[model samples]
Target chain A: MAPLLEARSLCKAFGAVTAADNISVAVAEREVVGIIGANGAGKTTFVNMVTGYLKPDTGSISYQGRDITRLGPRATARTGICRSFQIPQTFARFTVLDNMLVALNVARKRDLFFWRPAHDAELDAVAQGLLAGLGISGHRDQIAGTLPQGVRKILDIAMAMVSAPKVILLDEPTSGISTDEKHAAMDTVMNALGERGVTILFVEHDMEIVERYAGRVIAFYDGRILADGAPAQVLSDADVRRYVVGGELHRRQPRKGVA
Target chain B: MSVLTDRNVLVLLAAIPLLIAAGPIMPDWVRFFLQVSLASGLAVLGVVVQMRAGLVSFGQGLYYCLGAYAAGMTGHFVGVTDVFALLGLGIVVAAGVAVVLGFLMSRYREIFFAMLSLALSMILYGLLVKAEVLGSTDGFNLPKATFLGLAPTEQALRFAVYALTCAVTLLAAIFLYRYLKSPMGRIGEAIAQNEIRVEYLGSSARTVVHITYVLAAALSGAGGALAALANGHVDPEMANWTTSGQFVFVALLSGTGNVAAPLIGNFLLEMIRVYAVAWSPYTWQLILGATMLLVILFLPGGLWSLVERRKAGG
Candidate 1:
């Protein structure tokens, strides 16, 4: 089967600084791929180029056999690719349910002028279902901005899932959440996507969380992939050790034996 | 049936008949008050559209003046005094100008958009002030509008026109309330919140904003035409920056949550100005400025939010 998303030699730059340089990766259907990188390692920039938020200065992106390299962000989303931000970008004043509903509307191809009560009821059911799947049903009526960071992150993931995307990109999905809450949030996100058979490519800084969830891991440094393989092999690679793993993986090596 | 059931809108619908009835029983000043309130309500609704989308437009007066001038010119040069035709001409002219300006204005964001719109409107104001055919600074006197060839010279006719204005304004308000609850309106809110995110979601922020700008301009033009019809005159000051500021002030005072807020603000402002001038003619500006400052300081979300908070508390 064709890869769900394929990027060939993707290259992007910001003036003198290259943000994504000669990167080629493919995410298979139902696969969970993690990108681990340090600060300013071009992870977010790579995701931006793939999602059409930024144009790659070189190379091409194809989703399920369609060349979508030059397509706008909205077109990419319509073609079954969606993304969540590092900091959840939600309608702050809107309720969690309303935010989900808006996303559903974006996914819809129906005429908006029709004001049938039945249509609204169907949308409500779908939004509630997604929120429940993300374990955020209890906060459905709560204003999104007022929610805790972990819950807000879940809501952001839930919004992205409204379209039932083929490939979902999460930019530091566990960022700014408490340690105890981070695992729970990741479990919810992974489980929801797994149930939908959705492929995910997420950027994460937490090594354990990345190891626990990622079936395949790719290490990025200075706008290029430094390593790619199973979590154990990639995390243990010498280049990844020096550039990305640093001394942290060495500290965790004894803990791996404990587990 | 849904329209009739809405309590907030029901009051405005009911006010039209009540105002018309009072014209026969009450003084001429009361009838004039009703007419001014109706016109001001329409203008305020125009402002609500911009404010709700998190835009501060200083160019609404451009459309308002265009509508008024269009009506006046059509009556003077084209000899069309039919109310419906005059209003239609005003809408077409205003919509045309909005489409052209929106193309440029929608490309700009935040303070840049506001300043560009202000500059464009000011240029139009200057052009109108200098045009000899448009009566220059002396302004144009509009012919009395006849309703389907029936010209009534009685006080009842003025009341009838005012009642018509109220009906049109209420219909527009109701339509706007429903429109804002639609998907397109939600997209506008999304654009205001995170424009880039909205774009990534398969929607163009520029398209959404441009549509909104044009719609608001068309409505403001409708309001301006009604004002000119009621007063039987159009002036360059109708589209002045200060006039645009007054619309924004009323909108900010009203808030975006309720359609009635702007109408209420307009009525209150007009009544307060009337009373203030009666007491001391030159002090109306001071009173208006002070009242606006207080509203901005105490009720930042506008009067509608205050009403919502009070109801929630109760």
Candidate 2:
């Protein structure tokens, strides 16, 4: 089967730092993929290039057989590829529901000059339902900027889902979240986005979350893919173990039972 | 239809009759002050409109000047005295200029946008002062406007212009109030809040800003035409940076809290200026500057925040 999304020989550089170097990765339909990497391993850079936030210096990115290499952020989003930022982007002063309503209004293609009210009963209902689906409806009227990090992350994901995207990239969906709260936040994000045939690629540092959630894992090391296979296989690869998952896996290995 | 029931909309609608009735009893200077306030209030309304999208057009008077010139020159050169024709032409001319300039203007933000706008209006000011046919810096007089071919007596003519000013301003306020509630308007506010999010949501921030600039220019055009009719003249100073700066001042004083806020803020400024000049003619500008500073320090939302606070029960 043709890959749902494919990146071919992608390379991006910012002066002396090589963010993505000769990297290529393909994601299959309905597959939940976790991307593991150390700090500055180019995981987020990969997401940025794929989402058209930054144009790769070399090679092409295709989604569902259509070239989107030069498509900028807004056009790329319209093509059913959407992403949530590592830092949640929202209208800080608006209430949570208002932010969602704005998202819904903007989801209407080329209606920038429509005379109709942007938030009618229909749009409001959709926003409310989406918020409820993400289990953050209680924060509907609270100002978005004042919300906790976990709730904001869920709100960001909720806004991304409004477009009914075919492929969604979440950059550290659980980052900055308390360890105790990250699971619940990820659960909300994953459950809300668990629709059939939607490809999910999430950049994550947590090995346990990746093992539990992703069907496949792609480990990144210093701007290159170190290992790519089933979660168990790649997580145990020698180079991936040495470069990306070494200290992280040490915490879970059978420390006392080895004797 | 629901827009008509909004409190701001109601305030706008209510002002029409109250002002027309009050015009006959006020002194001539008082009536003139109200007319200038409402006319220039419309110019300030354009500034407030752009402000919603978090854009500050320091050259808003470009449209104001164009609108006035459209009216003034229409009467001065083409001999069209009908007020409606003048106002409509004003809108068309201003909108036309905006459609052209908005391409370059929407590509900028923050200080760059503000400075570019200021530069464009100054360019117009420079050209107008040098053009001998347009009376150079001294400018030229506007022929009195007739209402649908019916010529009123002198007193009635003054009152007609004042009444017309009230009605036109209210209409602009009503349209803007509705716009501020619409999705296009919301997108503008969203663009101001977060341009990246706006783009990611599948809308163009540039398109929204362009449309906003055109709409705001059309509004200023209408205001300029009215000011020309009221003052019986048009001058290069109308496009000068100081005049544009005053529109910005009125917008700030009003706080962009609502469409009606501009009218209230402009009238208050007019009354304060009159009083300051009367009490100490030489120091009136000093008083004006000090008043603005005080408002900035105490009421960051401008004069309208007091009303908002009262409504919010704070």
Candidate 3:
């Protein structure tokens, strides 16, 4: 079967600086593809281009066999492509469940008429289930901004998951999360997506996360793909070693007893 | 409980009749106060829309004037004194203007948006002041409005008009509260927080903001038309930048939380103006300025947020 999402030679630039340079990748259905890069390796830019937040100067993005490169974010989302921001950018003044309800409305393509109570029992149930899956059912009524960082991260993923998209892009899902919560959060995200058969394309700086969760890894350096293969192969590659993986591999080697 | 409920809105809707019935029992000045409060309250609702979406539009007066002028002109030349028809024309004119101006206004941000709005309203003010047919600077006086077909004279008619204003303001307020509670409402809040993030989430911030601008303009237009009907006059000063500033003042005093905030703010301001001017008309502006400064400094989120805090604590 054709890949669920295909990016062909995508390139983006800002003034003289190139953000994404001649990059191409594909994500298969039900696959977890990890993008590993340094601070400004254009990981987020690549995701933005795919999700239609930013248009590429060159390249076509096809989702489910249709070209969606030029579609705006809402159009792309309507086509079952959604993204979660690096930080949990939620409706701070609203309740957690209300946030999910908004996502559910978008996913179901319902006109937003709050006076007319939502009649989609299935959507409500699904949102509750996702919240429960993320272990945030206890705080369903809490204001999203007041939640702990770990819970907020989970809520962000949960909101994205509400759309039931074919592919979901997570930008640095565990960036500010505490070390103790990172693994659990990642596990919940991956497991929930896996259970729903949703494809995931996530960017991460942590090589251990890439190794543990990613079925495939793409390493980016200086706005270009440095390596693309299994995590072990990409991590062991000499060029990746010199560029993206040098410090990360060295730090993890001792902990994994592989020095 | 959700304030967006139809039943809740209907219950509020029922209060309009009660207020209308009680209007005859109140003194003439009290009835006049209610009419002014309703007019200002509607304009403040327009302010709430802009402020809630992180926009500050100083051109609301442009639409307000558009409504007033549309109603005045239609009544003068078209001979349509039917209140509903005049209101419809006012809203249509305002929405049309908003569509044209919003295309340009939606592209600008922050202070530029506010400045552009002010410029647009000032341009309208200049035109109205220059046009002798539009009553030049003195403004046009509207004849008695015939409600549906009933023509009552002077005091009885003014009371009837005040009742109509109350009904329209309450309906508009309830509709706005419902609009903000919908899916678009959530998207609006997201846009206010982070436009880029909203776009990344597969939503168009521009489209959302533009729609909001047009809706706000339409509301302001309705308010302006009603004010003209209630006061029986239309003037260039209605479109002045000072009028826009007044709406902003009301919005800031109310915050954007509840539908009742603007009504409360308008009432308080009008009441203060009445009493302050009674004591010394020359010091009224100074008193208003000082009171606004205190409100901004002490309650930045406006009075609605204060009410919310109180409710949460209690």
Highest lDDT: which candidate? 2
The best candidate by DockQ is: 2
In CAPRI terms, where does candidate 3 land? Answer: acceptable
Global fold similarity of model 3 (TM-score): 0.93
RMSD of each: 2.4, 1.7, 2.6
lDDT (tens digit, per residue) of candidate 1 on A1-259: 8888999999998999998999999889989999998999899998998888899999999999999999888889889999999999888888988888778787784314423211277899999988888899999999988999889888888888888899999999999999888998899889989999999999999999999999999999999999988999999898898999777777766654465
- Tell me, by TM-score, which candidate is best: 2
- TM-score-wise, the better of 1 and 2 is 2
Which residue pairs does candidate 3 place in steric collision? A73-B202, A74-B202, A112-B183
DockQ of each: 0.48, 0.68, 0.46
Per-residue lDDT tens digits for candidate 2, residues B1-314, read 47666676787789899999999999999899889988988889999989999999899999999999999999999999998899899989999999999999999999999999999999999999999999999999998778889878778888988998899999888888888878788889889999998888788899999999999999999999999999999999999999999999899888997888899899899999999999999999999889989999999999999998998995
Backbone clashes under 3 angstroms, per model: 1, 1, 3
**Alpha-carbon error at B1 in model 3, in Å?**
7.5
TM-score of chain A, model number 3: 0.94
Residue A170, model 2: Cα distance from true site in angstroms: 0.3
TM-score, every prediction = 0.95, 0.97, 0.93
Native contacts kept (model 3): 0.50
Q: What TM-score does structure 2 among the candidates reach?
A: 0.97
Candidate 1 regions with alpha-carbon error over 4 angstroms: A110-119, A255-259
Better of 2 and 3 by DockQ: 2
